[model samples]
Target: MSTANTSNNTDSAIGAPVSATLPTLSRQDRDDSRPQQYPSPSSPHATSATSPPIPTPSPRNGRAGYQLSLPIPRLQRSEWVNLEGLVECALSSLGKDECTGISELGRGSHNSLYEIRFSDGTSCAASISNSPRQFFSADAKRSEIATMQYIHSSKLYKIPIPKIYSWDLTFDNKVGAPYILRECVKGKNLSEDGRFYRLNARDKQKVVKELAHVQAELSKPSEFTQLGYIYRQEGENGQFYVGKMATVPSGSDEEDKMRESFMGPYDSLTELWEARIERETLCAIGNWSQLPSDASLPSMLPPAKANPQQFGELQQLLSGLTNLFTPPEQLSKLCIHHSDLAIRNVLFDEKTLKITGVIDWEFASVMPLVITGRFPNDLGWEGNEFARSLGKFGNVSDGGVWNHHYYDWTSLSGVQPPPRADMPSPPASPTHSPASIDYLTTPNATANGYLFEHQASVLEDFDNSEGRAPSPPSPPLPPPPTSETSQQDLTSRATNLVELYYYRKFYASKLAARNFNLTRLFIDAVAYIKFNEIVLGGPEKWFASADWIKEVYWRMQEEDESAREDLMEGKGVVKVPEVFLAVRRREVDLGKWENKVMSMR
Candidate 1:
């Protein structure tokens, strides 16, 4: 990483640029593709009389400048941002005399990050939310600061959280935007670190174990009675309290807009669901009427307006399914969850692979343990197509079954198994095949058994010694060991599959050993549904079929019955289709969709 300051401004903040010493850029830094220059603070762009333009860095390479772009016209603003003012605010907060330089660190969906270096050799990260509407609430910045402070002060978890030095929730400050200045966590994001993917199965398991432990610790304090955003109360010694749930902004600048920005600190999960459904219903109806016929709508919005009565029907259906969405009493308690636990949000040491800090708590909120508990996004088998294919054979938690299936195929085909110390011994009965192994006896297995058997048959096709006629699967199998499809490629794929199985198995076991209740909640089907609903918007937006409302109602009924039977029989777990657990796919698809829409804009 380049330590030299990238900012062009000299001693004076928000003043004419002056000549200063510049560091030589490394080859890597010189080749970096992101825009590097910050717009001059003294730019001649006129500011709105009512609200000054939020300063943003402009690209000198003639590319589109980094700015908050939204579908809402009223929320769109100029790309010019007061970078010098932001640096000055950070310096003032840290009690620094002079700034060495400021450089853009990165940009996320909602915030832009910068690293500001001071003359004293100290640096801090500033996360600036370019638009208050990002979170659909004005209190987004304040709530985030409060959440970070509460977690940092509590010291209840082993994971490191950044310390907030200062923050502004409004554009009243010189920064001209809401920003949080905090200690710069001295580590690289786990996702950005290439070394992580190169680790052996055992080492990868260690990382997964640590992440699971962090999640277990976060679930320790689950006594919160209300489901909402945490906020710090007013006064000199104000305490944190669970407050209204943040929702979409009403797009009104009036006083009532603030009130509408949040919905409720619901007493129960049902109430929260009801509030959410109602909000989405209204938003859908409003969008249907307001948007032009030819205008492109975000995926979250309905494609076309339904019968006015259908909206009510959808709301009622969701309202009645609340119980199905609710977990058992033990797992119903609310706990703080980092809803977006992507690898990019996690910081870790490159040498030891120990997690240093977790950032981006803007979306963190109190929610039911069932909904909060799950494997972190990076640990899930969503992005890797091979891993996802393996998932078709069994549940993610059934690592032993996957291992057995892999070994069964490799043994029959006379292929050597990958060198893995963690690989479990094959099934005791050598004759046991994927079709015969009863890893899960639940209805879920029966529902997906055919797919599993089909995959098993395809693997059998690789072996011809039995003289059985080959029945290849739809996705054609690789031709026999060509240069392009060598044994090494097959072995590599098998290794990846085995590693994912072990990683998930280890993660689940770690959660169970640390907190069994959390493990139970982690696998709860209804909880995954609720989590997906939050991420991909309401179920209404999930499909284009007009019968989606009806489909959701029927599916909930079936799940509810299955859950009841499992509990009655002491099984204690509700299993659903793999599609419900495909969170990574939904998230990735949404990102791509959003980016496409943004480009169109």
Candidate 2:
């Protein structure tokens, strides 16, 4: 059918709640001035020469509430849709027709959002999967829709989630794509809103507290018996069930094979970790037969070929560590968690500073609590200058006191000590009066002076027998403030630093207070180690160096001891050692280096 005729038929057939007088574009308008075409970059059917060029929205356009248009590549030809078909399906889903507007909201890594406004002033968002690879497949979409619906229907979870209106898992529908049409959450994304930073410390604390509450709720145990994605049965009121894991595509045919082989509803954490390691290993070493005819080995494998033997050894190491950390009781249950909890995924009212909704559930999955439990990324101030300044002031322990010797008050207060030579000497003793000292200075009196000096030296030699250096003079107290303005500025900065520290502390405390297990799982060092081994190629890339391995192993042992002590004491928070942080920094740098090398190929 013609696009316009299809829209008209949809409006009349559905009896949509849209005005009958809504305008329709003429044939000329439809052909010349309709929204621009966005063809998939990987599609064989590229736009013809007569078609208009693709649109490229500037960065500023995104900030101005316009979509950041970009070419979205599709993994299969069936996942293609025309604008008219998209609008028609969206209208049918909303039970509305003759919509006032259909505008692109934004495009993400795996999907694109479009805002569909109707004549009655109501609006809904349609999220269409742009890539149907291993991660954004039809199964993944089904799981995401089921998850959102389950959360929306359950009264146990007080977290604000957008209501799902309709969803399609097949590409044969009118939309010609797997999609979910849901309520258009009203409010700016928390990360994009500047009002959050300007709030008073109390209000800011409240924000983090609420976020913590939401996270705690999400980490609650589920009825599932395995680790995987949630899927609903094929009925109007179907029951949700655990299904195969949804994973990211590695942009290679080997990734497809690996996913089919390793994706599972695993019975144990060890099984899951092993499957992940195996997948990463094989995908890193791409399938030679599946490579394009013209592609070179370097283009697929990057720096060098991967050693399967090394991957096997790494898997064994991870297996041992996973067993060490995984409690037997936790293996039988799973908890659902948002894949990414950054501020960008959070919507909040600017006036009340309350979270209105949480969006982007395509990657959410049901997994072991240890894997699901994590602090919200927004509360972290890892690379902030203020956080660094606070760290220099002192390391705050779980008890909310500066316990360790990490404090450098002199540096924080910006005070410089006077030179050693300028320090005042003690007054001369009565036995060695000034006049007696003058006589000692005279050349004729050198014999007595030499004998006295030698006698004093004997005592000094006795004092130095232990080979300890003499204690240095103490620094003077800081001088009085130069101005009230400077004092106010210092106070303001100090207050900000304190707030930053406590915001994270408060979040950890909330989780710990509910159940120390949550905190334990959140900071589980074994999980980080596994991530390094599988995702970052830690075993093959860095573990070969004896010094690197030794440092990481030592840090791991220290963390293990500290974790044990904290558990015994029923403490929720464990201060990470500086050595671990240094190691993570190195890992981050290495990841960047690897990316750079890959780009060069």
Whose TM-score is greatest here? 1
Off by over 4 Å in 1: 1-78, 132-137, 193-195, 247-262, 284-316, 381-498, 525-536, 542-574, 579-601
What does candidate 1's lDDT look like per residue over 469-499, in tens digits?
Answer: 1111222233323224456776765655455
Model 1, backbone clash pairs (residues 3+ apart or across chains), number? 4
Task: Spell out the clash pairs found in candidate 1.
Answer: 55-81, 55-82, 56-80, 56-81
Give me the displacement of residue 566 in model 1, in angstroms: 12
* Shift of residue 472 alpha carbon in model 1, Å: 33
Which stretches in model 2 have alpha-carbon errors above 4 Å?
Answer: 1-81, 132-136, 170-173, 193-195, 249-254, 280-316, 328-333, 381-499, 512-601
lDDT tens digits, residues 190-299, model 2?
A: 34223355668788776777677777778788777877788888766789888886544444565456567877888866676666556655654554435443234222
Q: Estimate each model's TM-score.
A: 0.60, 0.57
